[model samples]
Target chain A: MAAEPPYLELLESVDSFPHIDISKTPYIEDESSSFYQLLLPNDARCHGYIHPSVVHKLAWTASFQVSHSIPRTVQLLDDSDGKDTAAACSRAFYEVIEKAVDSKIYPFLKTMQWENYRIVGAKYPTVQLLRSAARLFGICSRGAHMTAYVRTNDGIKIWVGRRAAHLFTYPGKLDTTVAGGVRAEESPFECIVHEAAEEASIPADFVRANAKACGAITYVAKSSTAYGDDSSLMTPVILYNYDIELPEHIVPRPQDDEVEDFYLWDLEQVKQAMVNRAFKTNCAAVMMDFFIRHGIITDENEKDYLEILTRLHRKLPVPTSPSEA
Target chain B: MAAEPPYLELLESVDSFPHIDISKTPYIEDESSSFYQLLLPNDARCHGYIHPSVVHKLAWTASFQVSHSIPRTVQLLDDSDGKDTAAACSRAFYEVIEKAVDSKIYPFLKTMQWENYRIVGAKYPTVQLLRSAARLFGICSRGAHMTAYVRTNDGIKIWVGRRAAHLFTYPGKLDTTVAGGVRAEESPFECIVHEAAEEASIPADFVRANAKACGAITYVAKSSTAYGDDSSLMTPVILYNYDIELPEHIVPRPQDDEVEDFYLWDLEQVKQAMVNRAFKTNCAAVMMDFFIRHGIITDENEKDYLEILTRLHRKLPVPTSPSEA
Candidate 1:
């Protein structure tokens, strides 16, 4: 084991990844707004151009695709002209994307779950989204998660989950106790309660009674798309964090197959597991955030506390699409 | 009173100011970034110029005074080079400002309580700071406040304190149960504890133990400075909100002269007071945030819910002095 760093002497050594600078990533295409990219994992590049006819058919009439490079165009909507078309565009676009995923992406249909959807807007007042499947397609989706822990007499204990092997991504990796994506019109609180019931056998009523609003963690990162090609997908996510002080006896059992097993570990065990990369990368970040907020990882104990905080929040581009405005 | 507007049917009608178009405010000068302007309250103007010598003497060495129309250059630091000079500059600037406050500002400063002195940079880290007196000067200072509430049997109850009639600004205005400026090196949690003890006579230990972090409310507004002139000083504020659930029968009594009286008002009373503008403008926003977050105010019941949420969060500009890279 590596010797403890001078800053984080209060905690054990951590093997963590340095933050990637998302802002520095170039659009790579003229028509692309800094907010999103086509995420053509197959081409090994961003800024892919799509046919203008496809965009028009999808009702993204206001969005003009750059025909420069590959024939993939990004969705850059002008706020005013785009508002009326949002619902129609999302419906049309996602339908094609869904079909593409069903064929191109593997074994995603069974894991599909309904989520309140917003295909073309910044958070609020979604244009005609009843619901949509939330699974492998979430790479391009905006999402939220909740982190929960229990206060013990000695210290605090966090419950971590191991994803079932059959899961599409990060299978068998560690995850948060309760997490779910925000469905259309559902608030973070509502999502958390619903997730608590589905992921863990925890009763919805119990979660509703006990949960407390902590805040949120937001990030935009380039991620892997449908295929594990050299190309990447740029996705935006906002994790609505919650600190639940679970009762000692209320052990969470897997309600669905999303989670394999649960483990209640103290901070030390969590640190060790994190160092071993036992947790999902996103889950690790969330756990680290919880530690920093709770004072477990202070400036005295962590050298990169400031950098960590800075990395945790990304100033998302203002949504200019008429629907978002 | 006339029936509440259909928009706020759940609450009473508000005779409040219309939303100010902050984005329309022009940059004061060529050198000055749009972030800080010579706030012209009710005047259709911007780009005020100030002397370079004043900017230098004020220890804004890393910052250049924009001499367009702005009479006095405001201290807006650029991120890169200004990072290192932050501690020293904040120390120097606040020192002179403090002296100016003592000698020139006004006669009554007994209300000035010690605030952890961090004058430079936008919150988060304060390298080296001693305590400085906190008061009306907070307008020119970065401040944080905690809006604490308790869960009553019926719905929810908030602790409201009427400011003493003798206080400098907004005398006798209603305020949050526990609110104060974050002193240098004092975390929001610590400041809340200290303020709870000083303002409400709430036990520090109890506050430290029970208080929960809900989130924060941030805004940039025009404020008054030492020289009360037509050119308002643009002030930026971030209120770190907290929700504390106190056990029943644990009434909060005013411990200091800051608070005249404390009332445990339920949701209805709080909303009525908010509509009546009994609470300070900022305090009213904070309470509205609390109500909205708690689901007491929803899109179904409130017309301005989306607008309110949008107004609550403002994307502040990055602090960059001319020296910033």
Candidate 2:
């Protein structure tokens, strides 16, 4: 057999974070605790993992209305009359932390684009957090990705995107044809349809009619911005994957700065790019899963076929869907 | 929202077995050992698990050529000049054990149909074991299943089969359109193609042209025949799933007694059957996975969408593919 393909390495890179028992981590306002578990007001489940650096600041923020009702648990106290008090309190803390922390030390805090990411877990209602602070709090965020392809005389050709170099994270990396974070209060399908039009210039009507909700790709990876000294965060992501077959006449062009250009590459070209590690880590996984489902990657050709399939769909410790309030 | 649909119960049924620390199980022909780990000749991997009742008999069968090279492990000794000595020795011991033990006490032994199941594990060459004895020794078995559906005027319709009532196992339970054990040396695709012709009477030429190989479903369940006495066993299975869109002109008829009849059911009818527990345990999982991939089961409708998706594709402890040898 040829040397093990680079695909497994890409998967491991995303799943590279060490397994830490959040249950054993400090919950109360214990300064000695290296990590803090995010908890809801009354829910018993751990909502997220917060590093000590952010936890210290969160404990000092009086307006945030945080609580420690249970021993060794950090629950966000929301007694206000607002409908989405959890979101209000969380946004308040993130804003305070952004001003208090050094941008050079915590670069992610400086890239607040106002995109809201909804975090949900267990019995706790959904809370909207700033997208840039999702990784800092070790929250499980949702995204929608779509792979558009066309059947041509040559064979199946996939639409690939190159991220703009000016982007904040994974800049200049290859990405799926259309991908974006599922903003607060947006369903995965609606998010994908919106992203297709904004990122790929595909008409929303065309996407709605053609995009097939294939399933999802999930993984828990250490945030790329982890400074590895005093601060680190776990970033669990669930990307609802979609596949849309476009006609030869419908060409995809970049409509935003998120993507530099689009290329229709054949299977061999896609595999080469994957092996070369040009695609973003999770995007490679989404494409790899697509290949398996489409039969391009089979048990015969890929030795790690089963491993790849299982790894791509790791069960996140946090809840994936929003709680109906 | 809707009483947490019965789908999760079906998944829990197949994955209902408790996890045991197989590493702690005794080996090296220890009479006091409750369970014995099966080791290969000169291979370090734990190939299978043996209940004490079967292990006691295996240790006494000298001609079967078993050894205890390592502490707390039963290694099958294969030093003969003949090819595939492991299979030959295993067959010899199983035959003796069958006659020594009463058939009424172990009913699985009485129904051997001479079907060979190829068991593969880490670093070990594949060994063929009798299909009836696979569960007796806690071996990982391979099977192939295909769901045949057609686009109808009303909606999409699937071809489902009812197992023959006279069958010894899971009799009268509903099953996928085509499913069968993948025998030694047969690829999953080859096995599915063969089963399509033999079980469903679908033309081989048509199946070959239309069937799409769409990954696999894996699970580890306690054998139903496990008397829950001293002779229980774990059964790990991997079923390669295929999707074939048959034209309305073509209809499937039962070609053998394995299936009594085939019915074309709509989406709601299939969901009702799934909820009613009319389908076989693992077959329900296959259909559930199908619905998710086809977009019938979605995050909006199903609260446990991510959990179900991850549970359907479990990572088996044993190797899924055969070693080159």
Best by lDDT: 2
Please list the residue runs of candidate 2 whose C-alpha ends up more than 4 Å from where it truly belongs after superposition.
A1-5, A18-35, A52-73, A78-105, A225-232, A321-325, B1-5, B19-35, B51-72, B78-105, B225-232, B321-325
| TM-scores for the candidates | 0.66, 0.87
lDDT of 2 by residue, A1-325 (tens): 1233467778888776653334443442355545556766556667777766666654344444444333334566664566666665666656655564554455555664668787754453456677776776778888899999999898899999999999867889999999988887888999999889999899999998888888898888876544323545677889898999999889899998889999999888888888888898889989987887888877767777777787788767666544422
On residues B155-259, what C-alpha lDDT tens digit does candidate 1 reach at each position?
Answer: 678889999999766789899998887766766678888889999888999987877665455555544443342233344455666777787767788998989
lDDT of 2 by residue, B1-325 (tens): 1233377779989865553344443442455545556665656666676665666554345444444443344566664556767665556546655564553456556665667777755453446667766776677888888999999899899999999999877899999999988887788889988899999999999998889888887877866644323544667788888999998888999998899999999887887888788898889998988888888788767877887887787656555544422
The residue pairs in collision within model 2 are A27-A72, B27-B72, B27-B73, B28-B73
The number of the candidate with the highest TM-score is: 2
lDDT of each: 0.53, 0.74
Residues A1-325 of candidate 1 have per-residue lDDT tens digits of: 3333222222212212122323343344443422233422122233222223223323233333333343333643333353555454455445554554456433333345544565333322454232333222222244456566788786888889889999767889999998866766676678888888889877889888877664445555444444332233344455666667788788889998899998998877888877677777777777866775565664334544443443454433223122223
